[model samples]
Target: MLPPSVFESAFNSSPIGKYLLSPTPEALILAVNDAFLKACSRRREDLLGKSLFVAFPADPDDPASSTNEAELRASFARVLETGTPDLLPVQRYPIPLEGPDGTIAFEERFWSAYSAPVFGPDGAVTCISHTTKDVTEQIRSERALRESENRFRALTTAGQVVYRMNADWTELRELDGRGFLRDTDSPRSFWLQDYIPDDEQARVHAAVGEAIRTGRVFELEHRVRRIDGSDGWALSRAVPICDAHGRVVEWIGAASDITERKAAEEKLRESDRRKDEFLAMLAHELRNPIAPISAAAALLQRMQLDEALVRRTSQIIARQVGHMTALIDDLLDVSRVTRGLVELERVPLDLRDVLQDAVEQVAPLVQARRHTLALELPSQATIVVGDKKRLVQVVANLLNNAAKYTPEGGCLAVRAGAQDGGACVEVSDNGIGMAPELTGRVFDLFAQAERSADRSLGGLGLGLALVKSLVELHGGTVGCESAGLGQGSRFLACLPCLSGDTAPQGEQDDEPMAQAPAALRVLVVDDNVDAAVMLAMLLEASGHEVLVEHGARAALARAHEARPQVFLLDIGLPEMDGKELARRLRAEPATRDALLVAVTGYGQDSDREQIMAAGFDHHLVKPVDMERLEAILAGAA
Candidate 1:
């Protein structure tokens, strides 16, 4: 055992604060060492004979001080009653200090305390020994760490793809993708290869190198491999995290899924490109017919020629005009069909008869090409419910394509029969076939194979598109197959077959209507001077008194004066259009009963509706069908 003097020396020189208090309920302070006096900022004489509570009074303003005081007193009481040591918890215990101005202020502090009972000779507790150590700096450091961890959690929980990378970006330390990407929890050296697509990895590598060299933020819109192994897009950004010496330690990054937005942008770009191509093609097509027509007209006006030569020149003009008109008609037809404006006239009919009509329409083209045509039809009648005219049109278009694309002396076959519970019409040709890429989208609008500079195989690429649309409108399907270029191609159309009923008998052809022989007064109005005069001349050739007017106002005045029985008015006129003229003519007593007809270039359904609503009795698209117009005039006569 140590001597009494040595034990007292150790207690007084100890770094921890130590004190002794009487073991009574009053708990009066009996002694204090040098460390205790220094810690409390008090002298030994000031505390010795005073109660422990009086020496360390609780601060009313500091709530933690009150708690610390209660805990210390409880610990001391327990040591006295149990005659054992009691370890106190770490707590905030504020101390009062005198400032330079003699004002007392409380300094915030944290401490860990302990108390033990001291036994006397009689084996009874004489006093309690207390020790305290300051722990303020450690407590404050722990609190700051907790707050940092909470902020990190909040960021990861949001819909952001947070990631951490090594200083040079050569390694991926961690990643929380939040479902937008694949998560990485461990360091990876092959992270770039695993996350980025093969074609896009080089670009990512270049970006990473630049960001590392410059110590700048990295930003890129790039492709990524999704969790399901599908291709996706992301807008990624990473900023350099620096150390105290201004050296980059790592990268903190986030990414957003931009897959849907990128797809929409690509679609818009493709649409714009296609529209520009279509406009250029339209200009080329229009100029082709215009060149020949202009040349023919100049030859007729500038030269003296024989009757035969003059007739030949006129035929050239008429043929080129017909070709131009056909091109316009195809454009309008496709537009109407795609917009769901065409209505089918569905009727039960024999498929054989429909095929026969289609064959007749394409017979001229086939003979000119010197192609051998073969027809394979079923023995019995194949009945189907469809529009006979549209069905004929569909077959004719397919057969025409075969004739146009096949070389001279090629063979073409049209086969029709009942197959797969439906009526199938197959058109096959031993001709130049399509490439693999072209076959897939051949039915799309304006999609076509490569054509020569002269465009010898003349077409606007609307035939197959129209065939597909019309077949689908009849609740059927159409498909094409080819064995590469120069082999062969086949087109198949399938339509639902009519069952459990006999085919309806074909309707008899209508007799030709009788012509009106008596001369009738007629008025023709048009914005073009040539169109008005030519129409007037045609009327006079039929023994009718004809008046020509160049505008709507002139036509209305002429009709009122002539009291004409027939009126052919153009829809597009200067200052006043044909529909308004028709309405104004209908209001006048002199021309109210006239057979009003519309002659215009506009032929859409909406245009037709407007014409009819303006009181016109007949609507005709230009160049007017002379036979139909004659019929209308004959009915009026």
Candidate 2:
């Protein structure tokens, strides 16, 4: 043991706060070292004769002080009762201090304290020795670290893929994929090659290099290998974890699976691009016919020509008008079919008759192209339950498409036979074929091969779409195949076949000979003066007395005066619309029994329903087929 004087000096100079307390129920303070006095910011007289509770009171205003005081008191009592040493937990104790205004205040502090009992010669407790050290900063640091850990765990649980890597990104230390990718618990040296796609690895490397060079946050959206071994998109971001000198030691990062979002964005972009392309194509196609018609009209008006010249100009106008009408009809047909408006009139039909009709329909085009047309059919008639007209249209459209795409004099073949319990018709052409990509989307609406400025292949890209839709409507399928560009193409159509010869009833062998319409008083009504005059002139040429009027009221007056037996009315009138005009005409006594025909540009199924409901007997779409109109007139007469 040291001398008494040296021990006193050592006790006073010790860094830790030490104090002695009386071993009584009150626990009064008997003595305090210099360190204990300085730690509490008190003078020796303030604590020497005071109880431990009196010198350091638990502040009622501070909730942290309440429980720690009870705990410290229990610890002191235990040490004295057992005559042994005891340790106290970290405590939130408030110390009293003197302010400049001679007022007393409490300063919040934390401490770790220990208590031990002193023994007398009889082995009984006499005094309790107490020691303390300030530990406020250490506790605060621990709390901050725990909070950081909690936040990191929350992020990993909430669908964020967490990862840690070396500063150079050459090795991955750990990863939790959160189910977006595969997890890696051990260090991986080839993480870049394992996670990122081969095509995207270089891009990721560049981003990593930039981030490392500048010690900045790294961010990239690139393709990655998913758990299923498929390439998917991910948005990865990482920030450098630096040392005290701002040198990057490692990188901590997160990634999110963005595969679905990226796919949706790409689809939207493609749709927008297709919409713009379709609109441009529409404008181009419309202008093609309009240009010729406009020129033909100018020629007729500006030049006084001979009979041959006049006839040629009229034919040019008629031809372009017919082309325009065909284009409009195609548009209407596709619209009705796509919207499920067109209902097929199904009947048992022989495939031979359909093929014959289709061939006849395309014979003119075949002849024009000077191509050798080969048609192969089964020895016996192949029967199918389908709409005859629609089937004929399907085959005719395929032939016409082949003709249009094939070079002049190129070979075209149509082969039909029984296959796989159904009938298959393949139309193959030795002409300019399509690329592999085009073959897949050949039947999509507005999908077309690249055309020249002249658009030598004149079509609205609707034929194949119509063919596919019509085939599907009849419970059939259509597909296209091509070797590649310039290698020609083949289109195949499959339809369900019927077993027995169940020919449709009332099937005519041939149409009855057409009769000439008897001369009758006819009144033609139209909003367009030109249309009215043209129809009237044509009717007069057919040996009928024809009267023309531009509107509904005038047509009604003319009908009453002339006692016309037939009335051809345009559906779009000025004051009264065509449907209303037709109703009024039927209500009138003079023309109520007259034949009412709807002649207009509106040709949808709904338009026909409205026209027929309004007392019209017949509906004709314009630039109407005069042969069909004449046949209707002859039948009515």
Q: What is the lDDT of every predicted structure here?
A: 0.81, 0.81
User: All candidates: CA RMSD in angstroms?
Assistant: 34.9, 32.7
* Model 2 worst lDDT run, 10 consecutive residues: 148-157
Could you give candidate 1's per-residue lDDT for residues 1-637 as a string of tens digits?
8799998898899988888888876789887888778777677756889988776677878777777888887888789778899998887888777653346788877889889889999999988988888787678656643443333322223344677888988777556655433446567674677778999999999998999999999999898776567777777889999999999999998766666556867977966775666566667777888998999888888756889989898889888888889889999999877756677878888888889999999999999999999999889889889889889999999999888888999999999999999999999999988888777777887664243235567667788889999999899999889998887789999999997376655765543365764788888889899999988887798888998889777777777677989889998899788888888988998888888999989898767877899999888898877777777777887
Candidate 2 clashing pairs, residues 3+ apart or interchain: none
Clashes of each: 0, 0
- Give TM-scores for every candidate, taking all chains together and pairing residue i with residue i: 0.70, 0.66
TM-score of 1: 0.70
